[model samples]
Target: MRITTETVAAAMKSALPNKTKYHFDDDLAGFGFYRTTTGTGTFFAEFRTVAGGSKKRLKLGRVGTLKANEAREAARKAIANAALGKDLAKSRAEGRAAATVARLLELYNERTRDKRKASTADGYDLIAKVNIVPHIGATKAAAVTRQEVQRMHGKVGKARGHYAANRAVAVLKAAYAWGGKHGHVPEGFNPASGVDRYREEPRERFLTDAEMIAIGDAMTEAETIGLAVDAGTAKHAPVGQRVVMSPYATAAVRLIMLTGARLREILHLRWDEVDLERGILRLPDSKTGKKLVYLPTAAIDIIKGLTPIGAFVIAGESAGTKREKPRADLKKPWAAILKRAGVSGIRIHDLRHTFASIGVGDQMGLPVIGALLGHSNAATTKRYAHAADEVQRRAVEAIGGKIAAALGGVK
Candidate 1:
């Protein structure tokens, strides 16, 4: 039932030895409550902030910890904080110490934008919007604790997929680190730290040379690669399977395949940042927010092939409409390519994994491969640096010495 302070007063008046239900309606800010959802003294307070806004709930305290007067006082304080511009939702989030999650996200995005690429900004938005905001967005940045982070890690990292959870944590940690350095959040080691606890399991996704050849050939022949629908044909996929692939798609996919530049980088490419004649594509700001990527010959060829007669290399295939251009999924083309190549369960991103593997197979150094991939750190590159089991075993069982010894007698 709906709760308010008057109902809470009535429940407290009828209280017995067990935890009792209470409600409070403060400031027409809507109604909230104090009750036990599962019984046995575990109290929860649920409420709505505005007359028609969403209903939000928070855990108040245990039976002994919260008396009616105590709950009433707490509610009063919350209302006061809200009136004074603090949010209880934020309170339930990070605890009671630092900045709120919302503020941190805002700061990070604002500071990183034109300073970085549109794609980079978009990526941060996705991760924050999906993982952080829904769970702990309201939490105060300073109030977030190690235990809270651990619980979160368990949930988001889920049972077997820890990579995404780890990434989300990394983003938070980086934010905190930045916060401390710049006086955004208090100075302290990241709450998400401690490798032994939140450590991630290994994930492998790389293609062999044979697999690469097959997939590449398949992609070249696939009928329906994704592209932004030009204006005249917004509702339907283009009549012709191939529309010369927009300058963006052509250069972007080629670049993505060759150098594995994030899709955002390709979407936001500007002519001024490239020097086709000099074979250099300059990134004004990287994810690290420092160091421009210097594209070598092959990457240059991909960019060279992408010359939009106007701004944005892809020139956006909106067909001259106000609506934003649609991203090319490559799903159909990817599926066809995979089927033709007899491969399954691989993603376009794996093509990036392919780039790293091919580099490793060619005996190129790890650091060189990373630099080519535009990774700012060795750690990021190492994810793709791991060779397949067969490949690794091939190195150990070369039989170079033994073959030479058997031939040595002949020699």
Candidate 2:
């Protein structure tokens, strides 16, 4: 008999205490009313998503909550979807799994963690926590629009500066691309694409000879006499009348100035990577892949002075643990040293630029400077060409002066 209100009510009344009863609609193949032995009646739909596939039973509300006609329409839609080879239950489950953008980001980070470098993974996590998630995390992953992403980019650019905003968008783009490819969101969907990036001016600031002298003096003071602060008298206190700095951090800075190596390269340096006899570092991996850094005598001396702690040359706090890690950063020690030196607007990275600029000012050829800096591309070293031109102009001016004086004497 057709599962109408009358049939469902009759089935519920006739449902034996020891047995269950079911009534199917005459016109609809899979729509039915089910009565349990406890006399509770519910509407249900049963169908196979594919031919010969296992049948799926979907509960369509209780008898009184949903009239028979209402349940029949729902069953018809579900049956039609099943005929199109769509698994409604599975689709609903997947939608719930990545319902929100925050959930999607969490899945993206967890899945892609092993594929990225530790530093890169950490940067992505920071971008999500500090930038991306806070803005659009509550939005549905499937419903995020290009307009929303563009708006987010604009806000970040205004608040955090262009470079930081650009980095955050880059991570967002990667996350969306990964989600689309992996079926978390709709395939070929990416809201982060085509968002205009803010224009960024590259930093050209480098230290002069006087500034270098000041920094050197500061380093000496930190290692020996200790820099004076306004707070307490503790040896390692950040706020203290006199704070003696970490020897490892001081050495790391000295190595950066002398060797022109990147910050991470020095911080993550292992003892096995050092070749003191040859005065070179055999870095297994760097930003530019495997790198070979030739060390001067001064850099070698700094390395020799350091006491080895476990695997890393510049020892982090977890140096002796089973999972030994490199020094997380050089921010604190660099700040103290800069304050003591009375230097402003000088970043740690500027030390690398200073090394290259000095070489160029001394008339070292661009190719030689490039090689010393481990630059794979000659074009990257071209920024120092102006310094070389200045050196040439000075040489010509001196030559002209001497020539004019000799000519006057002869006359």
Candidate 3:
């Protein structure tokens, strides 16, 4: 008899006690269903691994869970795989025995700890926790599909933003690549390999001269008379209350603006790396590896004025203790200063961009700007090309205005 929906329903209804009956599609030899005496039924595909090999059964699903056409399609694929010497049942069983994606990620993290920077490893762990592991970590590493990774990417993009979603997929791709290299997964089987990533636009924010003056003024006020806190920001404080900022944090910001150094480079700066006499920072390591940061007089003055609290130039509360550490971040002080200065939509990193813009405005040349910013790649500093063009345009405009004025003082 043919194993269609109606026949399966009839078989389930007429099933006898303490007995089992098997029915199959006459047109498709391997596609069939088995009904138990208790009235339960399951659909399955029974096929030989090869032309004359022993038979294997791959369960499609229960009758109600999977419809007739769906089961038939599944059976066809199973049979096709069997003809190719692939046993679907054995592969599924082996997948069940393989390490889960979470386990693979754990191993990947542990094995690559020494190879990755501490901050980089921490970032991977964060991405896994916040995005990846929560979604597909339980699936067997070998069985993870591209569709699953794509879904995760789409979901993250919808909830978070494209930037965050892209970061999540990037970490997943790296994890899978690492897993493949280390034999934790099949060498050529990376689920995230072909998944399309979200497009990301580079952020461009430069501080204008007026804005810079405002920020500097705000920093000075924050250190002395204190900046007023926004109403309702603090739980206990009344509206328009004032709070003094940390001297070290203010100095750190000034140094960033003056020297164009990255937040971490300045925050984690140690006394040994500084040379007051030479006006240079002998950084042993930065994002671009070992580098020399020539300091301006203003930058040197800011550093010299800071009272050393610990090994770190910018000291946190835990400075000078057994757990001596640099300042964790300058979020609070930076925010207050921006609010006081009426500046919005600016990040601390933007200060670095502002520095590059200033250098371009001065026609310092891209090479000099790149060297000062410790950019190992010329492409990175090339982002400031627009600023250089703007400066040149203004200069040409000035020359044209002079010629025009000399030609006509009548108008």
Candidate 4:
């Protein structure tokens, strides 16, 4: 029957609840309506590929959504294109194969697993998970534009911070570069390119002597009370009760303050990494790569006091268990310590700065302090130069005052 408005209306009204049926147009080939047993009708185009290949069907719209004439015109164009050697089905499949941001991130992680450290890889994964993926993970890699990248960068900067924004953009840049190199993204298509990055000032916060003493007192009090008790333990109270910091955590904090090592460096410190006889810590890997941290007597004593619970000098709660893993973070205990000490606006990393500050105040040479702190180069250690200058200025003022007193008595 001819596929006119009347014919389609009749098919819709009389369609049976048995099986699907097709009503092709009498004037146009391959244009029709598929009537389902539920009385629903849809327009579709049926065409062959390469004149002798398999038939392909493309759904256009529902009967009410598309008129018979419009469906016929669309089907005619589709059939004509099919006859001209285009494979509409294959093209659809290729469109589905186009790379998305999520897919590109997965590929980037896999490719850089060996090239990046576990900590570095974790940072990248965090940037993708917490920042980039939530914003545009579903967007096609090839379709991402510089405008979208800039907007994301700006929004992240406003919401998080400028430094975090810069890091997030760096992650995006690396992902796009990796994708483009591997042909996952189009050549010369880097959305992150030319997007301005936020300028970040170096943030250096050192603990004052009073703040340091207060924190030490807090840690001591914490140790006496014990850190939070383990859950499901009848021997102790429930979680959230003030308990001592695990001996490991207590000793770890002391060492960081005494030695100026990074938090992760101390948390991940293994028994094999310590050299007690030489008073040195031979770090096999660090932010600046391999380094040797020269430990003073105080630092060495702190390390000696710690009783190794597992392979790690600072063991987590899983110590001595089959599922034991080294302490990966110190967020909870550190937060509690900070609260109890009444200390604000100081971070765990600030302990390192405090150590450098004290060294400079004691008239320790910058080069010597740099070596003790395991600085990779002089430039990285230059931040402490002002502390040394302050010390020298005080010495000169004392000497000049005595000389001036003697000249006044002679006059």
lDDT of 2 by residue, 100-172 (tens): 8888888999899998777678778888888888899999888888899888888988887788889888888
lDDT of 3 by residue, 31-56 (tens): 99988777777788999997777878
Local error of candidate 1 at residue 160 (angstroms): 11
Rank ordering of all candidates by TM-score, starting from the highest: 2, 4, 3, 1
Ranking by lDDT: 3, 2, 4, 1
Quantify all predictions' global Cα lDDT against the true fold. 0.61, 0.85, 0.85, 0.82
TM-score of each model, paired residue for residue? 0.49, 0.72, 0.68, 0.70
Error of 3 at 173 (Å): 1.2
Off by over 4 Å in 4: 1-97, 158-160, 226-240, 318-324, 409-411
Superposition TM-score, candidate 4 onto the true structure: 0.70
lDDT of 4 by residue, 1-411 (tens): 888888889778883858899888888888888998878788888888775777888676678868888988878887888889776656654553587888888889888878988879987888888778878889987788889888888888888789878888898989888765544665457889899998888878888888888888888887887545445332555666756666677788888998889998898888999999999888898888888877889889888887777778888888768888778777767777777788987878888988998999999999988887888888888898889999999999888888988889632
Q: Which of the two, 1 or 2, has more lDDT? A: 2
Q: What local lDDT does model 3 show for residue 6?
A: 85
Q: Please list all clashing residue pairs in model 2, or write none if there are none.
A: 232-240, 232-241
Candidate No. with top TM-score: 2
Clashes of each: 16, 2, 0, 4
Tens digit of lDDT per residue, candidate 1, span 111-144?
Answer: 8677656766776777787777777889877777
Error of 3 at 314 (Å): 1.3
Candidate 2 segments exceeding 4 Å error:
1-99, 109-122, 134-139, 143-160, 229-240, 409-411
